[model samples]
Target: MAFDSSDLKPVGARPPLLDYLVSLWGARHFVIYDARVRLAVSQDHTVLGKVWLVLNPILFGFTFYLIFGLLLQTNRGIENFTGFIIIGFMMFFYTTRSFVAGARSIANGQNLIRGFSFPRAALPLAINVRQALSQLYVLAAMFALVLVVPPSERVGLHWLLVIPIFLLQTVFNWGLGMLFAPLVHKIPDVGNIMAVVTRLWMYSSGLFYEPSRFTDNATILALFHLNPLYQILQMTRGVMLYDTLPSMEQWSLLVVWAGGVWLLGLIAFWRNEESYANERR
Candidate 1:
């Protein structure tokens, strides 16, 4: 058997990166529709429907406050520990959810990838889209909680900065999904591994507690500063609580992480585009 043909293209061939980007742009409507459908399907079984979006996090915040604030007194040094806990958990979970969904995007959509000819990046992009949309409800709940709870942050120009912060985080999530998708596709069980890994990342990312607690140790403090998520969290707290912009240090780290990861992920995932078409279970 011999085969050498320049005229034949693989049936599932992915176009060049620029072509792929153009295809994704063309498929933007599909992405939006798919994301909305997924969110609807996710809530299909829940009796409370959209209410769960607001209720779930509210309950989680109350539980954390009971243990960390009321019992353990984790709020001792903080003025608005109530808002603190909510912001930390809510903000951090956005990225965590993005990671999990992105990791599973390829594996879960293997059927679509094999059966369809669209850009594979669409799947991961849709995951981030779904999350960002859902956050609309969650953030509303968070803001309401902030006002009713102690140490209220008045609404002003500073609060508006959260919009950009969220957009930046979404970019970061998009990159994360791009980075994790191919790896998860190569190892299906890597999805499960990432779950545990992100759990650890959650704790280490300064979502559960303030980083100031570690001021006594330079090493620990520096470690927190290095985490892009922690940087976002600290900046978010400052905005919502104090009406301030991110310090120059935080701004530098955020931009570098978001842009750098996005570029890297785009290239890395593009390299695997053709391979994705053949990845069927």
Candidate 2:
């Protein structure tokens, strides 16, 4: 009560964009280190444990292959159909889990938010890291599937592109987490709606059918390009399975989604930082 105004930390004071980013950069270790620890803790409860990371996507691909590739002959238009399905489904799952995690991050971390004084951004950062780390196993499994599956494709320099592709997706997911974390924190029901949104996203994202199938319909094709998840999955499949560079259009879309969403998310999330501390219910 005796302190001057300078000593009083304003409740809910948001840092400028540049300074907020600097703080996040400085806290990168906390994000990564804590993520690793939490990743382990997060996995301990499940019976199948981390095995599900690799198994789940592979199983999903099998279901898609059974219906689309084998029954409906959706793969008729595409070469290396096995490899294509594997890449599309597995990679799409990464972003799905990332968004789900990000959407739930803030509301789930209320205890920490109420108790700690550290960076609120770190929670979303950690969620992305955890998702990415879990994905490493799945990525490895996908490569193995590519090698063993039909229409065998050789691994080459382009295979190395998975690293950058994953990096872009990770950043994109982090941004999404930032954008939704605050909103969901404020409104608990948003989580239920996000579940439906994610399902529609997966179905429309061309996980099994090639986007080229829609080429006759210019409007539909154009809409597919607008979906960042679709673009990223297309880009990943092009490089890893097709052994060709992604079209400039796909690359540009991924870059824009990754950079634009992450920047917007950070700003939005930070703007509400003060409220997180006092949020109840």
Candidate 3:
């Protein structure tokens, strides 16, 4: 068995950034198709099926309303606490699901990764889309419920701002998903750690209360503004509660982090695409 010198060729330099992005852009069709297919199968055999999306958030909202709005008396002077909590819970949960679900994407889909040859990022993209779609039903139902509930606010086009906010949040979620895939694949315990961290994130994100209430200390107030999750929740709150545009500063931070994470995740994930199918814990 003799090895030939020509057969020992070196790998070429990585593809240019523009070229890589173009390839991803061209692969959008596959991403959409996969997203739809996975979305369909997500509730294939379930009894409640898609209704779970609507039901789950309402249930959680009730729990929060009971504990925070009623029992704990944490509402302070905020108006329409129920509707406020509902919006925050639904929107934040969407991203939480995408992050936690995507953590296992590479490890659990060994067969697909091994058998097929497509953009690996598509798996997380599909997961993100499916989760977002599932959660959208919750968003609609929550707004509708607010119409009937005694303390609920009336619907208006101002809430339409949710459209752009959600779209941008989706980009941020996908970026995170991209980053988590490889790290979780390498460290299986990252799954448990992420769950705990997301719980802390949920509490700290001020989904249940207004961050504006925290003005006791300069550092604390500044910390709330700098928190990315707080910024996102603020954006959602602006559209759903105040019917106003998000602050320029908040939007700028979200854009930077979203774009930076997306690029870093793309390069990181692509670097591991060829090995994903074979590597395991």
Candidate 2 lDDT over 46-156, as tens digits, reads: 898778778888998899999999998888888888888899989998998989888788889888877766668988998899899999999999999898787777889
Encode model 1's per-residue lDDT on 9-94: one tens digit a residue.
87667678898899989999999999999888887788888898778878887888798789977677776788888998888888
Which regions in candidate 1 have their CA more than 4 angstroms from the true location? 1-7, 279-281
- TM-scores, one per candidate: 0.93, 0.92, 0.88
Worst 10 residues of 2 by lDDT: 3-12
Quote the positional error of residue 9 for candidate 2 in Å: 0.9
lDDT of 3 by residue, 84-179 (tens): 787778888888898888767887777787776656677887788788877678778967876777675667787777787777788888888888
Give the candidates in order of TM-score, highest first.
1, 2, 3
Error of 1 at 176 (Å): 0.2
* Candidate 3 lDDT for residue 238: 73
In angstroms, give how far residue 169 of model 1 lies from its true place. 0.2
Sorting all predicted structures by lDDT, with the top scorer first, yields 2, 1, 3
Which pairs of residues collide in candidate 3?
A: none
Q: Identify the candidate with maximal lDDT.
A: 2
lDDT of 3: 0.77
* Candidate 2 pairs with clashing backbones: none
